[model samples]
Target: MSKMDIYRRSQFFISPPAILKVIEVLILVTAMILFLVDNKCSGDLAFVTIFVLPCVVVALATLISYISAVFVLVGRRNPLTTPTWVKGDVWFNIVSLVVMLVGSILTLTNEGCANNSLTVASIALGFISVILFAISGAVTYLVLVRHQQEVKEAQRAQLNTRRVTMSELA
Candidate 1:
Protein backbone atom coordinates (compact mmCIF):
# COMPACT_ATOMS: atom_id res chain seq x y z
CA MET A 1 0.00 0.00 0.00
CA SER A 2 1.06 3.59 -0.61
CA LYS A 3 2.08 5.83 2.28
CA MET A 4 -1.15 7.77 1.85
CA ASP A 5 -3.21 4.61 2.27
CA ILE A 6 -1.30 3.62 5.41
CA TYR A 7 -1.76 7.09 6.88
CA ARG A 8 -5.46 7.03 6.11
CA ARG A 9 -5.92 3.69 7.86
CA SER A 10 -4.05 4.94 10.94
CA GLN A 11 -6.20 8.05 10.95
CA PHE A 12 -9.24 5.81 10.93
CA PHE A 13 -7.95 4.13 14.09
CA ILE A 14 -8.50 7.31 16.07
CA SER A 15 -9.91 10.49 14.59
CA PRO A 16 -13.60 9.95 13.89
CA PRO A 17 -14.63 8.52 17.25
CA ALA A 18 -12.52 11.01 19.21
CA ILE A 19 -14.00 13.90 17.31
CA LEU A 20 -17.54 12.66 17.93
CA LYS A 21 -16.95 12.23 21.65
CA VAL A 22 -15.56 15.75 21.85
CA ILE A 23 -18.67 17.12 20.16
CA GLU A 24 -20.90 15.30 22.60
CA VAL A 25 -18.89 16.68 25.51
CA LEU A 26 -19.18 20.22 24.20
CA ILE A 27 -22.96 19.96 23.83
CA LEU A 28 -23.41 18.52 27.29
CA VAL A 29 -21.24 21.24 28.82
CA THR A 30 -23.21 23.96 27.03
CA ALA A 31 -26.50 22.52 28.20
CA MET A 32 -25.23 22.33 31.76
CA ILE A 33 -24.11 25.95 31.69
CA LEU A 34 -27.45 27.13 30.30
CA PHE A 35 -29.39 25.15 32.88
CA LEU A 36 -27.25 26.38 35.75
CA VAL A 37 -27.60 30.01 34.70
CA ASP A 38 -31.35 29.65 34.40
CA ASN A 39 -31.62 28.05 37.81
CA LYS A 40 -29.50 30.76 39.45
CA CYS A 41 -31.55 33.56 37.88
CA SER A 42 -34.86 32.07 39.01
CA GLY A 43 -33.83 30.47 42.35
CA ASP A 44 -36.69 28.01 41.82
CA LEU A 45 -36.73 24.47 43.24
CA ALA A 46 -38.68 23.29 40.24
CA PHE A 47 -35.96 24.52 37.92
CA VAL A 48 -33.42 22.45 39.86
CA THR A 49 -35.47 19.32 39.36
CA ILE A 50 -36.48 20.00 35.77
CA PHE A 51 -33.35 21.54 34.33
CA VAL A 52 -30.31 21.11 36.53
CA LEU A 53 -30.60 17.44 37.39
CA PRO A 54 -31.01 16.34 33.81
CA CYS A 55 -28.04 18.44 32.74
CA VAL A 56 -25.90 16.81 35.41
CA VAL A 57 -26.89 13.37 34.19
CA VAL A 58 -26.10 14.29 30.62
CA ALA A 59 -22.72 15.73 31.54
CA LEU A 60 -21.81 12.59 33.44
CA ALA A 61 -22.77 10.51 30.44
CA THR A 62 -20.66 12.64 28.14
CA LEU A 63 -17.64 12.26 30.40
CA ILE A 64 -18.03 8.51 30.31
CA SER A 65 -18.22 8.57 26.53
CA TYR A 66 -15.03 10.59 26.25
CA ILE A 67 -13.07 8.25 28.49
CA SER A 68 -14.29 5.20 26.65
CA ALA A 69 -13.33 6.61 23.26
CA VAL A 70 -9.83 7.43 24.49
CA PHE A 71 -9.41 3.95 25.86
CA VAL A 72 -10.44 2.41 22.56
CA LEU A 73 -8.05 4.56 20.54
CA VAL A 74 -5.10 3.90 22.82
CA GLY A 75 -5.83 0.18 23.06
CA ARG A 76 -5.96 -0.16 19.30
CA ARG A 77 -2.46 1.29 18.91
CA ASN A 78 -0.96 -1.08 21.46
CA PRO A 79 -0.16 -4.79 21.06
CA LEU A 80 -3.52 -6.08 22.24
CA THR A 81 -6.00 -6.62 19.40
CA THR A 82 -8.85 -6.91 21.85
CA PRO A 83 -10.86 -4.38 19.81
CA THR A 84 -11.47 -1.80 22.49
CA TRP A 85 -13.73 0.11 20.10
CA VAL A 86 -16.48 -2.36 20.83
CA LYS A 87 -16.29 -1.51 24.53
CA GLY A 88 -16.34 2.19 23.74
CA ASP A 89 -19.43 1.73 21.58
CA VAL A 90 -21.21 -0.10 24.40
CA TRP A 91 -20.40 2.70 26.83
CA PHE A 92 -21.68 5.25 24.36
CA ASN A 93 -24.99 3.41 24.14
CA ILE A 94 -25.21 3.33 27.92
CA VAL A 95 -24.58 7.08 28.06
CA SER A 96 -27.33 7.63 25.48
CA LEU A 97 -29.74 5.58 27.53
CA VAL A 98 -29.02 7.61 30.67
CA VAL A 99 -29.49 10.91 28.84
CA MET A 100 -32.80 9.80 27.34
CA LEU A 101 -34.12 8.54 30.67
CA VAL A 102 -33.20 11.73 32.45
CA GLY A 103 -34.74 13.83 29.71
CA SER A 104 -37.99 11.91 30.10
CA ILE A 105 -37.98 12.48 33.84
CA LEU A 106 -37.35 16.21 33.34
CA THR A 107 -40.22 16.50 30.86
CA LEU A 108 -42.72 14.92 33.22
CA THR A 109 -41.70 17.12 36.13
CA ASN A 110 -41.29 20.46 34.33
CA GLU A 111 -43.40 23.34 35.64
CA GLY A 112 -43.82 26.60 33.76
CA CYS A 113 -41.37 29.30 34.72
CA ALA A 114 -42.27 33.00 35.15
CA ASN A 115 -41.87 33.14 31.40
CA ASN A 116 -43.55 30.03 30.10
CA SER A 117 -42.02 30.38 26.65
CA LEU A 118 -38.46 30.55 28.00
CA THR A 119 -39.01 27.46 30.14
CA VAL A 120 -40.42 25.53 27.22
CA ALA A 121 -37.53 26.55 25.01
CA SER A 122 -34.95 25.47 27.55
CA ILE A 123 -36.60 22.08 28.01
CA ALA A 124 -36.84 21.65 24.27
CA LEU A 125 -33.12 22.29 23.90
CA GLY A 126 -32.43 19.64 26.54
CA PHE A 127 -34.59 17.15 24.66
CA ILE A 128 -32.72 17.90 21.44
CA SER A 129 -29.40 17.29 23.18
CA VAL A 130 -30.59 13.89 24.35
CA ILE A 131 -31.70 12.89 20.88
CA LEU A 132 -28.48 14.08 19.29
CA PHE A 133 -26.30 12.15 21.71
CA ALA A 134 -28.32 8.98 21.23
CA ILE A 135 -28.13 9.22 17.45
CA SER A 136 -24.40 9.88 17.55
CA GLY A 137 -23.84 6.87 19.76
CA ALA A 138 -25.81 4.56 17.49
CA VAL A 139 -24.01 5.74 14.36
CA THR A 140 -20.59 5.30 16.00
CA TYR A 141 -21.47 1.75 17.02
CA LEU A 142 -22.62 0.78 13.55
CA VAL A 143 -19.57 2.23 11.84
CA LEU A 144 -17.09 0.52 14.17
CA VAL A 145 -18.90 -2.81 13.95
CA ARG A 146 -19.00 -2.70 10.17
CA HIS A 147 -15.34 -1.78 9.88
CA GLN A 148 -14.25 -4.53 12.23
CA GLN A 149 -16.33 -7.11 10.40
CA GLU A 150 -14.85 -6.13 7.06
CA VAL A 151 -11.33 -6.38 8.47
CA LYS A 152 -12.02 -9.86 9.86
CA GLU A 153 -13.59 -11.06 6.62
CA ALA A 154 -10.68 -9.79 4.56
CA GLN A 155 -8.18 -11.46 6.84
CA ARG A 156 -10.07 -14.74 6.57
CA ALA A 157 -10.15 -14.54 2.78
CA GLN A 158 -6.43 -13.87 2.63
CA LEU A 159 -5.68 -16.80 4.90
CA ASN A 160 -7.91 -19.13 2.87
CA THR A 161 -6.21 -18.11 -0.36
CA ARG A 162 -2.79 -18.75 1.13
CA ARG A 163 -3.85 -22.18 2.39
CA VAL A 164 -5.29 -23.19 -1.00
CA THR A 165 -2.14 -22.13 -2.88
CA MET A 166 0.11 -24.03 -0.49
CA SER A 167 -2.00 -27.16 -0.68
CA GLU A 168 -1.97 -27.12 -4.49
CA LEU A 169 1.81 -26.78 -4.57
CA ALA A 170 2.19 -29.65 -2.03
Candidate 2:
Protein backbone atom coordinates (compact mmCIF):
# COMPACT_ATOMS: atom_id res chain seq x y z
CA MET A 1 0.00 0.00 0.00
CA SER A 2 1.09 3.57 -0.67
CA LYS A 3 1.42 6.37 1.87
CA MET A 4 -2.04 7.62 0.89
CA ASP A 5 -3.59 4.22 1.58
CA ILE A 6 -1.93 4.13 4.98
CA TYR A 7 -3.17 7.63 5.68
CA ARG A 8 -6.72 6.74 4.75
CA ARG A 9 -6.60 3.68 6.98
CA SER A 10 -5.35 5.79 9.85
CA GLN A 11 -8.01 8.38 9.18
CA PHE A 12 -10.62 5.79 10.12
CA PHE A 13 -9.47 6.07 13.71
CA ILE A 14 -10.46 9.72 13.94
CA SER A 15 -14.10 9.20 13.05
CA PRO A 16 -16.74 9.80 15.70
CA PRO A 17 -17.24 6.23 16.83
CA ALA A 18 -13.53 5.55 16.72
CA ILE A 19 -12.78 8.55 18.91
CA LEU A 20 -15.48 7.54 21.36
CA LYS A 21 -14.12 4.00 21.49
CA VAL A 22 -10.67 5.34 22.30
CA ILE A 23 -12.07 7.55 25.06
CA GLU A 24 -14.14 4.74 26.51
CA VAL A 25 -11.15 2.45 26.56
CA LEU A 26 -9.09 5.14 28.26
CA ILE A 27 -11.73 5.73 30.91
CA LEU A 28 -11.83 2.04 31.58
CA VAL A 29 -8.09 2.16 32.04
CA THR A 30 -8.48 4.95 34.57
CA ALA A 31 -10.90 2.77 36.47
CA MET A 32 -8.35 0.00 36.42
CA ILE A 33 -5.74 2.36 37.82
CA LEU A 34 -8.04 3.24 40.68
CA PHE A 35 -8.54 -0.42 41.27
CA LEU A 36 -4.81 -0.71 41.56
CA VAL A 37 -4.91 2.01 44.18
CA ASP A 38 -7.59 0.15 46.06
CA ASN A 39 -5.51 -2.97 45.89
CA LYS A 40 -2.56 -1.15 47.34
CA CYS A 41 -4.56 0.48 50.11
CA SER A 42 -6.53 -2.52 51.30
CA GLY A 43 -4.26 -5.41 50.46
CA ASP A 44 -7.08 -6.79 48.40
CA LEU A 45 -8.96 -6.30 45.15
CA ALA A 46 -12.47 -6.77 46.49
CA PHE A 47 -14.30 -3.73 45.08
CA VAL A 48 -12.34 -3.72 41.90
CA THR A 49 -12.94 -7.37 41.31
CA ILE A 50 -16.64 -6.92 41.73
CA PHE A 51 -17.31 -3.55 40.03
CA VAL A 52 -14.53 -3.01 37.52
CA LEU A 53 -13.88 -6.43 36.10
CA PRO A 54 -17.11 -6.68 34.18
CA CYS A 55 -16.69 -3.23 32.66
CA VAL A 56 -13.20 -4.04 31.58
CA VAL A 57 -14.18 -7.31 29.98
CA VAL A 58 -17.20 -5.89 28.18
CA ALA A 59 -15.50 -2.75 26.97
CA LEU A 60 -12.48 -4.57 25.71
CA ALA A 61 -14.63 -7.05 23.88
CA THR A 62 -16.59 -4.23 22.28
CA LEU A 63 -13.48 -2.40 21.22
CA ILE A 64 -11.93 -5.52 19.81
CA SER A 65 -15.01 -6.37 17.81
CA TYR A 66 -15.16 -2.89 16.31
CA ILE A 67 -11.53 -2.80 15.30
CA SER A 68 -11.64 -6.31 13.94
CA ALA A 69 -14.76 -5.65 11.92
CA VAL A 70 -13.19 -2.61 10.35
CA PHE A 71 -10.00 -4.44 9.54
CA VAL A 72 -11.79 -7.42 8.08
CA LEU A 73 -14.37 -5.48 6.10
CA VAL A 74 -12.85 -2.12 5.26
CA GLY A 75 -12.05 -2.88 1.64
CA ARG A 76 -15.50 -3.95 0.53
CA ARG A 77 -18.68 -1.87 0.40
CA ASN A 78 -19.71 -3.26 3.74
CA PRO A 79 -22.20 -1.04 5.53
CA LEU A 80 -20.50 -1.58 8.84
CA THR A 81 -17.01 -0.20 8.15
CA THR A 82 -16.00 0.70 4.63
CA PRO A 83 -13.04 2.92 3.86
CA THR A 84 -15.31 5.91 3.34
CA TRP A 85 -18.31 4.92 5.47
CA VAL A 86 -19.03 3.44 8.86
CA LYS A 87 -22.11 1.78 10.24
CA GLY A 88 -23.08 -0.84 12.84
CA ASP A 89 -21.04 0.83 15.58
CA VAL A 90 -24.19 2.08 17.24
CA TRP A 91 -24.93 -1.33 18.67
CA PHE A 92 -21.66 -1.49 20.54
CA ASN A 93 -22.11 1.95 22.09
CA ILE A 94 -25.68 1.27 23.10
CA VAL A 95 -24.71 -1.99 24.75
CA SER A 96 -21.79 -0.32 26.50
CA LEU A 97 -24.01 2.38 27.98
CA VAL A 98 -26.03 -0.18 29.89
CA VAL A 99 -23.06 -2.18 31.15
CA MET A 100 -21.01 0.86 32.12
CA LEU A 101 -23.96 2.44 33.87
CA VAL A 102 -24.39 -0.66 35.99
CA GLY A 103 -20.71 -0.77 36.81
CA SER A 104 -20.65 2.93 37.62
CA ILE A 105 -23.61 2.64 39.95
CA LEU A 106 -22.09 -0.31 41.69
CA THR A 107 -18.86 1.55 42.18
CA LEU A 108 -20.57 4.72 43.32
CA THR A 109 -22.72 3.02 45.93
CA ASN A 110 -19.84 1.18 47.56
CA GLU A 111 -18.52 2.77 50.72
CA GLY A 112 -15.03 2.07 49.47
CA CYS A 113 -15.51 4.49 46.60
CA ALA A 114 -16.82 7.17 48.96
CA ASN A 115 -13.87 6.84 51.25
CA ASN A 116 -11.17 6.57 48.61
CA SER A 117 -10.34 9.67 46.58
CA LEU A 118 -8.93 7.58 43.79
CA THR A 119 -12.03 5.47 43.63
CA VAL A 120 -14.22 8.54 43.39
CA ALA A 121 -12.20 9.93 40.52
CA SER A 122 -12.32 6.57 38.80
CA ILE A 123 -16.06 6.23 39.02
CA ALA A 124 -16.50 9.79 37.85
CA LEU A 125 -14.54 8.99 34.73
CA GLY A 126 -16.64 5.88 34.30
CA PHE A 127 -19.77 8.00 34.42
CA ILE A 128 -18.36 10.29 31.78
CA SER A 129 -17.71 7.18 29.73
CA VAL A 130 -21.35 6.27 29.96
CA ILE A 131 -22.33 9.67 28.57
CA LEU A 132 -19.81 9.34 25.79
CA PHE A 133 -21.21 5.93 24.93
CA ALA A 134 -24.66 7.42 24.58
CA ILE A 135 -23.42 10.16 22.30
CA SER A 136 -21.48 7.68 20.23
CA GLY A 137 -24.51 5.49 19.81
CA ALA A 138 -26.56 8.46 18.66
CA VAL A 139 -23.95 9.61 16.23
CA THR A 140 -23.43 6.17 14.75
CA TYR A 141 -27.16 5.68 14.46
CA LEU A 142 -27.51 8.93 12.55
CA VAL A 143 -24.71 7.93 10.24
CA LEU A 144 -26.34 4.59 9.61
CA VAL A 145 -29.69 6.18 8.86
CA ARG A 146 -28.10 8.60 6.43
CA HIS A 147 -26.23 5.79 4.76
CA GLN A 148 -29.41 3.79 4.32
CA GLN A 149 -31.15 6.75 2.73
CA GLU A 150 -28.27 7.32 0.40
CA VAL A 151 -28.37 3.69 -0.65
CA LYS A 152 -32.08 3.93 -1.33
CA GLU A 153 -31.68 7.08 -3.41
CA ALA A 154 -28.85 5.56 -5.34
CA GLN A 155 -31.09 2.70 -6.24
CA ARG A 156 -33.60 5.15 -7.59
CA ALA A 157 -31.02 7.04 -9.64
CA GLN A 158 -30.64 5.91 -13.24
CA LEU A 159 -26.86 6.40 -13.32
CA ASN A 160 -24.89 5.46 -10.20
CA THR A 161 -21.21 6.24 -10.12
CA ARG A 162 -20.40 3.31 -7.88
CA ARG A 163 -22.12 0.79 -10.13
CA VAL A 164 -20.56 2.31 -13.25
CA THR A 165 -17.02 2.44 -11.91
CA MET A 166 -15.93 -1.13 -11.23
CA SER A 167 -12.37 -0.40 -10.19
CA GLU A 168 -10.96 -1.99 -7.01
CA LEU A 169 -12.44 0.89 -5.13
CA ALA A 170 -11.22 0.87 -1.56
Candidate 3:
Protein backbone atom coordinates (compact mmCIF):
# COMPACT_ATOMS: atom_id res chain seq x y z
CA MET A 1 0.00 0.00 0.00
CA SER A 2 0.98 3.58 -0.53
CA LYS A 3 2.20 5.92 2.21
CA MET A 4 -1.07 7.79 2.07
CA ASP A 5 -3.00 4.65 2.85
CA ILE A 6 -0.66 3.86 5.72
CA TYR A 7 -1.24 7.32 7.17
CA ARG A 8 -4.98 6.88 6.79
CA ARG A 9 -4.94 3.49 8.51
CA SER A 10 -2.92 4.93 11.39
CA GLN A 11 -6.05 6.87 12.40
CA PHE A 12 -4.11 9.77 13.85
CA PHE A 13 -3.37 11.58 10.62
CA ILE A 14 -6.28 13.93 10.48
CA SER A 15 -5.63 15.57 7.14
CA PRO A 16 -7.20 18.97 7.77
CA PRO A 17 -5.07 19.88 10.77
CA ALA A 18 -1.96 18.32 9.31
CA ILE A 19 -2.40 20.12 6.00
CA LEU A 20 -2.90 23.46 7.74
CA LYS A 21 0.15 22.95 9.93
CA VAL A 22 2.29 21.95 6.97
CA ILE A 23 1.21 25.02 5.02
CA GLU A 24 2.04 27.26 7.97
CA VAL A 25 5.45 25.66 8.32
CA LEU A 26 6.27 26.08 4.63
CA ILE A 27 5.23 29.74 4.48
CA LEU A 28 7.10 30.62 7.66
CA VAL A 29 10.23 28.84 6.48
CA THR A 30 10.06 30.54 3.09
CA ALA A 31 9.62 33.97 4.61
CA MET A 32 12.46 33.40 7.05
CA ILE A 33 14.79 32.21 4.29
CA LEU A 34 13.97 35.13 2.04
CA PHE A 35 14.53 37.58 4.85
CA LEU A 36 17.94 36.08 5.60
CA VAL A 37 18.94 36.17 1.95
CA ASP A 38 17.76 39.75 1.72
CA ASN A 39 19.93 40.68 4.64
CA LYS A 40 22.97 39.00 3.15
CA CYS A 41 22.31 40.34 -0.33
CA SER A 42 21.84 43.89 0.89
CA GLY A 43 24.44 43.97 3.71
CA ASP A 44 21.87 45.54 6.02
CA LEU A 45 22.40 43.45 9.12
CA ALA A 46 20.54 45.51 11.67
CA PHE A 47 17.35 46.06 9.69
CA VAL A 48 17.14 42.48 8.58
CA THR A 49 18.00 41.05 11.98
CA ILE A 50 15.23 42.99 13.63
CA PHE A 51 12.66 41.46 11.32
CA VAL A 52 14.32 38.08 11.03
CA LEU A 53 14.45 37.43 14.77
CA PRO A 54 10.70 37.22 15.21
CA CYS A 55 10.28 35.26 12.03
CA VAL A 56 12.90 32.81 13.18
CA VAL A 57 11.22 32.38 16.55
CA VAL A 58 7.82 31.82 14.99
CA ALA A 59 9.19 29.51 12.38
CA LEU A 60 11.00 27.40 14.94
CA ALA A 61 7.93 27.11 17.10
CA THR A 62 5.89 26.10 14.06
CA LEU A 63 8.51 23.56 13.05
CA ILE A 64 8.53 22.00 16.49
CA SER A 65 4.77 21.79 16.52
CA TYR A 66 4.70 20.28 13.07
CA ILE A 67 7.28 17.68 13.99
CA SER A 68 5.46 16.81 17.16
CA ALA A 69 2.24 16.42 15.20
CA VAL A 70 3.85 14.18 12.63
CA PHE A 71 5.43 12.00 15.26
CA VAL A 72 2.16 11.61 17.08
CA LEU A 73 0.21 10.91 13.91
CA VAL A 74 2.73 8.45 12.58
CA GLY A 75 2.87 6.67 15.89
CA ARG A 76 -0.91 6.47 15.96
CA ARG A 77 -1.16 8.68 18.99
CA ASN A 78 -4.28 10.76 19.41
CA PRO A 79 -3.49 14.36 20.11
CA LEU A 80 -6.95 14.81 21.56
CA THR A 81 -6.16 12.29 24.28
CA THR A 82 -2.70 13.75 24.78
CA PRO A 83 -3.46 16.92 26.70
CA THR A 84 0.07 18.24 26.84
CA TRP A 85 0.70 17.80 23.16
CA VAL A 86 -2.62 19.34 22.28
CA LYS A 87 -1.97 22.25 24.62
CA GLY A 88 1.44 22.81 23.15
CA ASP A 89 0.05 22.71 19.66
CA VAL A 90 -2.65 25.23 20.52
CA TRP A 91 -0.30 27.67 22.26
CA PHE A 92 2.37 27.34 19.61
CA ASN A 93 -0.06 28.22 16.87
CA ILE A 94 -1.47 31.11 18.90
CA VAL A 95 1.98 32.54 19.54
CA SER A 96 3.08 31.95 15.98
CA LEU A 97 0.00 33.69 14.63
CA VAL A 98 0.49 36.74 16.85
CA VAL A 99 4.19 37.00 16.08
CA MET A 100 3.74 36.53 12.34
CA LEU A 101 1.01 39.15 12.20
CA VAL A 102 3.15 41.70 14.05
CA GLY A 103 6.26 40.82 12.05
CA SER A 104 4.43 41.18 8.75
CA ILE A 105 3.15 44.60 9.73
CA LEU A 106 6.60 45.75 10.78
CA THR A 107 8.25 44.31 7.68
CA LEU A 108 5.84 46.13 5.41
CA THR A 109 6.70 49.45 7.02
CA ASN A 110 10.43 48.79 7.42
CA GLU A 111 12.70 51.04 5.35
CA GLY A 112 16.40 51.09 4.43
CA CYS A 113 16.33 48.34 1.87
CA ALA A 114 19.29 48.42 -0.52
CA ASN A 115 17.60 45.69 -2.49
CA ASN A 116 13.95 46.41 -2.98
CA SER A 117 13.32 43.11 -4.71
CA LEU A 118 14.46 41.04 -1.76
CA THR A 119 12.70 43.35 0.66
CA VAL A 120 9.50 43.18 -1.34
CA ALA A 121 9.74 39.43 -1.67
CA SER A 122 10.30 38.94 2.04
CA ILE A 123 7.49 41.31 2.93
CA ALA A 124 5.09 39.68 0.52
CA LEU A 125 5.97 36.25 1.81
CA GLY A 126 5.47 37.42 5.37
CA PHE A 127 2.01 38.75 4.50
CA ILE A 128 1.10 35.53 2.78
CA SER A 129 2.28 33.55 5.76
CA VAL A 130 0.18 35.69 8.04
CA ILE A 131 -2.90 35.08 5.90
CA LEU A 132 -2.24 31.35 5.87
CA PHE A 133 -1.83 31.32 9.64
CA ALA A 134 -5.15 33.08 10.02
CA ILE A 135 -6.79 30.47 7.85
CA SER A 136 -5.15 27.71 9.87
CA GLY A 137 -6.33 29.26 13.10
CA ALA A 138 -9.89 29.40 11.80
CA VAL A 139 -9.75 25.79 10.74
CA THR A 140 -8.35 24.74 14.09
CA TYR A 141 -11.13 26.58 15.90
CA LEU A 142 -13.73 24.86 13.76
CA VAL A 143 -12.21 21.46 14.38
CA LEU A 144 -12.22 22.05 18.10
CA VAL A 145 -15.83 23.15 17.98
CA ARG A 146 -16.79 20.05 16.08
CA HIS A 147 -14.91 17.86 18.51
CA GLN A 148 -16.69 19.46 21.41
CA GLN A 149 -20.02 18.90 19.73
CA GLU A 150 -19.21 15.28 19.20
CA VAL A 151 -18.19 14.85 22.82
CA LYS A 152 -21.43 16.42 23.97
CA GLU A 153 -23.47 14.19 21.73
CA ALA A 154 -21.68 11.12 23.01
CA GLN A 155 -22.24 12.16 26.61
CA ARG A 156 -25.92 12.78 25.95
CA ALA A 157 -26.29 9.39 24.39
CA GLN A 158 -24.67 7.76 27.35
CA LEU A 159 -26.97 9.62 29.71
CA ASN A 160 -29.99 8.56 27.68
CA THR A 161 -28.83 4.98 27.82
CA ARG A 162 -28.47 5.15 31.59
CA ARG A 163 -31.91 6.72 31.90
CA VAL A 164 -33.52 3.95 29.88
CA THR A 165 -31.74 1.30 31.94
CA MET A 166 -32.93 2.90 35.20
CA SER A 167 -36.49 3.28 33.90
CA GLU A 168 -36.62 -0.35 32.84
CA LEU A 169 -35.24 -1.44 36.18
CA ALA A 170 -37.87 0.69 37.97
Clashes (N, CA, C under 3 Å) per candidate: 0, 0, 0
Residue-wise C-alpha lDDT for candidate 3, range 23-141, written one tens digit per residue: 76677677777766645434556666656777788777777777776677667665544556656666666777777777666656665553467767877777777776766656555
- What is candidate 3's CA lDDT for residue 128? 76
Cα lDDT tens digits for candidate 1, 1-170: 44233224356435444465566556656655655555443565764665557666666766765665456556554211235655656565566657555764555364444344444455556666666666666666665566667678989999999999999999
Q: Tell me, what's the RMSD of every candidate?
A: 4.5, 7.4, 4.6
Whose lDDT is higher: candidate 1's or candidate 3's? 3
Candidate 3 residues lying further than 4 Å off, grouped into runs, are 1-14, 38-42, 70-77, 80-84
What are the TM-scores, per candidate, against the unseen true structure?
0.67, 0.71, 0.74
Q: Candidate 2: deviation at residue 67, Å?
A: 2.4
Candidate 3 achieves a global lDDT of 0.66
Q: After best superposition, candidate 1 residue 145: deviation in angstroms?
A: 1.9
Ranked by TM-score from best down, the candidates are: 3, 2, 1
Candidates 2 and 3 compared: the better one by lDDT is 3
What candidate 1 gets wrong by more than 4 Å, as runs, is: 1-16, 39-43, 76-85, 98-101, 104-109
Mind sharing the TM-score for model 2? 0.71
Candidate 2: give its CA RMSD in angstroms: 7.4
The candidate maximizing lDDT is 3
